[model samples]
Target: MADALTGVSRALREAPPDRVVEAADRAIRSVLGASGTAVFVADYRINGLWPVVDSRQPEVADQAGQSMVQRCFSSQQPVRDGDAGGRCRLYLPLTVWGERLGVLMVELPQEPSEEVAARAVDVAGEVAMALRAADQETDRYRRARRRERLSMAAELQWELLPGRSLSHDAFHLAGQLEPAYTVGGDHFDWSLDDDRLTVTVLNGDSIGLAAALLTAVTVNAMRNARRSGGGLVEQAELASDTVYYQHRGHRHVATVLLELDCVTGRVRAVDAGSPHLMRLRGGSVTRVALDQQLPLGMFAETRYDLQEFDLDPGDRLFVVSDGVWGADPSGRETYGQRAMARSMRATRLQPPTEAVGTVMRELQAFHADADLRDDAVVVCLDWHGSGDREGG
Candidate 1:
């Protein structure tokens, strides 16, 4: 008995699920001289049994074995009996952590003995212990995989950022990122030229790694298109094409691009499957809705229209990523467009940079403790200074 216990303990410690079940079957057959040995697990959904390992009857082994194992699963106790032909039929329930996992059965050669019954019980107990350990290990591996993906995404987000605040005489732009364990595919950029500033805010799909990669590629491509120089309409056309071709075999991004003339406060933009930019004038919020274009990479043939508006002094123009508009922090209630407009109007007197920060903070509070789907960017244009300047 001591030798059997020692062997079982060692096997339980060193063997994986498959090997432990195999070893237990061998030990039971050797000890009892049983004709066949079968190990079955419980399937709660079917209210039946499932054979994990077997020694005989391949054609209908699992089916026949499940019939007996299912019965043991409910009782969680041994079903020991002798057939009419004097063949010993043993069903030893397998349990661990106060839960019935399955059962092991052994059909003895002729008649059963006390020794055979004790050994079969030992085998069932040892197998149950091994399965519990294996289950815990599998759960650990799944958690690690989830964390690894999140880490990769967070790293990508940090790399794509410009980092510091950017402000000019007419407008000041700043953004804040909520703590996210996973990668979020949201970003914004504005480049200031002599008489014009090109601003863009984007939020791609929630595809994790793939979405993060596309966001980075599209951001760089748009930067290149603007630096390469052209008309506002021309830049939008080139940027749309660049995104379509760059993500040729992959996913796409939803974007909104705005061109604001520094001298005249003239605003022209194209919206590609994104929310409208909100403009606050005289304590009232109005949406500067542009014609919708297809999301980047969806079609090679989509075109964008250039909608223009003149920016008046004290006009607060706001552009934001979807994280602000779509997120629900309290685990309920999404922060919709109306909420965002209110947030903008409330902070109209503050500097554009600080106002953007306030909006991000409010969004974080609303979401309760949940992480955002993608990065949130709020760029506010106050059209500061004299409105008399004109150029470009």
Candidate 2:
């Protein structure tokens, strides 16, 4: 076991930036006496599981749609596939913490012992960490995964987001953007520092590349304020000041800035033209009313109100960009509050990660077969307060 661990570590650590996946695959196959090996990386941004490296056929690496990979990814467990009586393949989920990366495939010469299966799981995690590093340091693997060309604006917005989900002892939050391949300017970001969690929900109105630039500037300004120990209104103020002066008021960015005391479940918010902030409790969903102010870049003297509330255990908070509800205030063609209420009810029992995904899928079904789909975003937070009062 020590030798196997040392070999896997050396293979990934010593490999060149461009060849991490290939080296890991080689090491896995060698250690397990497998006839072949492969790794498929999931790029949820584009909804694809593309092949990075494969020793057998290149066709086998793109098997994300195959039943085995799908089962392994969703269940987040290792899958043994001699049940179908083919060549006896094993699929392992490559995941760390709460984040799901992709699938690892190992082809055995024969059915392996239980020890081999256990060891393969450990190696899969090391490979996942290496893949994360390669994704940042090298371009080869990323370029291979791009099945479609993204507009320069789309690329910027995609990078502005904090991955698709985040979880910890105090809260679980997940968010997603729609029309992911060619988004306008919809991004959500979050940071958990010490016991505080700050979140931003933004929607920029500019089109094309301008929208992307607007989002980039606004989100950074918000982060700067939050990291500097500013509250909700201060974050909104900084974002507005940056956009108004930098863009000369040429564009406006709508947003909701959220600050949570992760330990106490106390919630505070500043709304600068965000569409809605909904809370789900018991079996129903209701809008969390807040004082509204002009969007960033709209007014130099615009001031925001800091809204406050306390979330108990089992409470959910949702803030959405206009794209999710549509730009229409008239509510004729848009996804209306009634529809949203139903979805919140349906997904109330799911964890935050699954809840956001479920809502996105339902939104797509609501707009199915339509050529024009706007960029939509939703951030869902599930809060559980610290149990300091339990003894009372």
Candidate 3:
């Protein structure tokens, strides 16, 4: 009997909060030979303690409820005597830090004596200590998780942000990335060389270990493809080919590439399966419906197409990733092309970063506090060949 009680004490001391409560209830019923046991926690209203776990007698289990527990809580003392109506009912208040936390009730087959009352008190004290220890553990876990998330968020932001903007007097370009996690698959890059201004975006819907691999492949493939001897069309094809060959036809990816001449303000683009690119011109938005090609590495028979256009001084071109299209409000209403285009038209006068932020905020509000399902990227390119528009 002493050894069993020692084991119960050890369990209460070592277990977490949930386990501590469970162990306390189990020990009382087993050691005291109680017919039923209950653990009640005080409600926020402070008027009562509600039973969390109720072990009731088969004869009167249905009749006994929280109200029956009122006298024990009201007296703020243990009730164990022949005067009680049932076989035996013992109520011991579970207190901590000079405050009553709740009540622990034990129903006995006979009136409990002084020996049982003393043991019940000891058990209640152990339960209180266990509850405190469990609270401490829970608090520690919450702090650790908060710190970890902050660190992850910081790392993700640092990696995705470019060191500087890729803008000059002739042409201006900027982009924004908003991930639903610490790391996301939406990425855009722009490198200005002596020959051409290379621009690319890699939109990956990957996650977990696969997402990490996709990110590495996307970054390395873009760098290698841009450095290869090629135009935008050739570079995009090279990137697709590299991914396909590297994955051995096991994985798939989506990519786009563009080369703009600083002198002529001509924009050449190669779309390799991504969301439609929108062009805002003269107070209106136009969806440049490039051909829908297969994602990279899907199959050997996939083909790509290239398109070009002359950029007016005030023209704005927008490239979006699949994350935007995937986010649906109430899981039904999509922030589709029409909505995105409208947002584009409305924010045409805003800077690239602000425009993207506006769109993201709108999507967030539309979802009504739901979490973003995917990472999103938005890149805006504008031609300033005429030097007629204000910088934003």
Candidate 4:
């Protein structure tokens, strides 16, 4: 098993970023004596999976195969099945941490033993890691994952994201944006360091390319401050100042900056504008009332203030931009007036990974299945508390 993994790692290192998938496939077949191997990546909307390397003989071409692949991706578990010819097909999720990339399909000549299955799972993880790294060097994999062309603004916004989901010992975090192909003006970002998890949600004051550019500047400015050992206040102030100076107060971003202590559940926040917060504890959902302040970049040298909150174990917190909370179809009632809470209550049983999508789907239904008039973003965080901390 170690030798096979080493071979896979060596292949990954030797291959160019755009051809890593092909290299991994050759290594897997040679080391494991597999009949065939293929990697499938989820599309931009995550609505379907596409083969990253060979498309001539795609493994998931049929509906049944697609369903099986989707099951593996969603469940984060390996699935094994045998065909009439007595060949065994193994489907393993290609996941890194909590992020679900897609699935690895391996077709063995015959039924495999438990040990072989275990090794295949390990190989899938290695492939996932390689793909994650290759993402920085080439856009090959990114192109394979997109089912449709993205608007220039959406492309920029998508490139600025950390990832759609992340997992930690103390928390599970997931987020999503709507009008996926044309999204602009709304975005979310997070970073984890030691015991601190910093999260920021932004809603741009403009639309199209202008909003994308405004958000890009603000996000990078905050990132610069955070990387320089700054806290939430510093991040917000730096971002606000940078945006104000660049646009001369003509453009702004509504934002909420938060830092959570993984060990103690203490949260410090700077609420600069929209993107309201809601907390779910036990069975009830309530708005987390934050002191409203001017949107970032609204004025030169705006001073931001910090607010505090504590997250108990099993608490679920959601940060949603105005596009969601203020969504009104055809000038009807706003979704947040009641439906957003109802949607949250309905998805209470789901994990953050699934809950984020469910809430977005509910919002779509609220819009009567029409294209959303504005960009929307939703971030969900489930605090499990620190198991290693005594009395946590």
Instruction: Pick the TM-score winner.
Output: 4
Q: Encode model 2's per-residue lDDT on 1-392: one tens digit a residue.
A: 87997899899999997988778868987887777777877765535566774454334633433667767776678998763545667888876555666788787767878998889888888888787777778887667666678788888887777666776776778887766668878889888888788888888786768888888998998888887888778888888988898867778898888889987888888889885788899897888888887898887756788888889888998887777766333446666457767787788777776677676766766666353356788889988767643422
At residue 326, candidate 2 shows an lDDT of 62
lDDT of 1 by residue, 1-392 (tens): 66876676676677664455566666666656777676666431123455653445221255544555655655556776566888866888776633455677777867766776787787778777777577555542223213223456556765576532455656655544444455467777667788677877777666567767777777777777777877555655666677678766356678888888776778888787784577889799887767778776676756677778887877888777677777765656677546777787789776654576677767766765456655665767777544433321
Clash pairs detected, candidate 3:
none
Clash totals, every prediction: 4, 0, 0, 0
Candidate 2 clash pair list: none
The number of clashing residue pairs in model 2 is 0
- Model 4: residues >4 Å from true position, as ranges? 53-58, 388-392
Candidate 4 lDDT tens digits, 1-392: 79889989999989999988888878888877888887899887677788886753346688888888888887888998789999988999998988888899998999999999999999998999999999999999898888889999999999999999999888999999888899988999999998899999998888999999999999999999999999988999999999989888888899999999999999999999878999989889999999988899989989988999999989999999999999999788899989999999887888887888888999999999999999999999999988735553
Q: Rate the local accuracy (lDDT) of all candidates.
A: 0.65, 0.77, 0.64, 0.90
How close is every model to the real structure, measured as TM-score?
A: 0.56, 0.88, 0.56, 0.97
Distance from true location, Cα of 209 in model 1, Å: 3.0
The window of 10 residues in a row where model 4 has the poorest summed lDDT is: 52-61
Query: Candidate 1, which ten residues in sequence have the lowest lDDT sum?
Result: 140-149
Question: Cα RMSDs of all predictions?
Answer: 22.2, 3.4, 20.5, 1.7
Alpha carbon RMSD to native, model 4: 1.7
Over 29-123, each residue of candidate 3 has an lDDT whose tens digit, in order, gives 78888777776665322344555532442222334545555555544567653445557777777655334456777778887778877888777
Clashing pairs in 1: 153-183, 329-366, 329-367, 329-368
Error of 2 at 242 (Å): 0.8
